[model samples]
Target: MEPKNNLRSLDRQINVFLPAISLICILCIFISCNKQDRTTVIYGKVTDQNHQAVDSILVVAGGLWDFNIEVVKQIYTDENGNYELVIDVPKKYIKLNV
Candidate 1:
């Protein structure tokens, strides 16, 4: 019958479209759940007790979150004892080690 054929066509279309729409919705949820990362810039000069530039020194920058320290950047001082570090972390308590 014509009505039975119409029902079969509708069912076929639903079976094909439902899964595609569900996949798109699931992807949107996952994309919205992602968080963007933030960054901080640190610039300083390293010097010894005698006020002399300390070059080639290792400098580490870390962020303290939830009682955990996560290292974000590690760099060495330049010949002029100047160091620049870009850290990707949240704005919070941070620790520096030289």
Candidate 2:
């Protein structure tokens, strides 16, 4: 009787621990699947045909992903004609519109 009870107790413990372990594993996999794998940094000079700085021109970066399309960010060039945009790396392709 004592050995049978012990087996039952051990089974209960395993049942409880097994679900917890499975839950942890599922959570880990979910997090990994949702994780962003890369990032993007863009730098360019806004210039006119005459090679002059075009200040205040709006530059936008659009990101394309499997799930959705999003505007990553928008930036404006400084007086020096330099612009920068930092965003999560797109899953497939990224389009830069100036």
Q: What are the Cα lDDT values of the candidates?
A: 0.82, 0.81
Candidate 1 lDDT: 0.82
Clashes of each: 0, 0
For model 2, residues 1-98, the per-residue Cα lDDT tens digits are 99999999999999999999999999999999988667768899989999999999988877656655667789889999899887776556555333
Best by lDDT: 1
Worst 10 residues of 2 by lDDT: 89-98
User: What TM-score, over all chains together, does every model reach?
Assistant: 0.52, 0.52
Query: What lDDT score goes with residue 25 in model 2?
Result: 100
Count backbone overlaps in model 1. 0
Task: Give Cα distance to truth, residue 10, candidate 1, Å.
Answer: 38
Q: Best by TM-score, which number?
A: 1
Q: Write the per-residue lDDT of candidate 1 for residues 1-98, one digit (tens) a residue.
A: 99999999999999999999999999998878755466668899999999999999999887676688877778999998999987666656554433
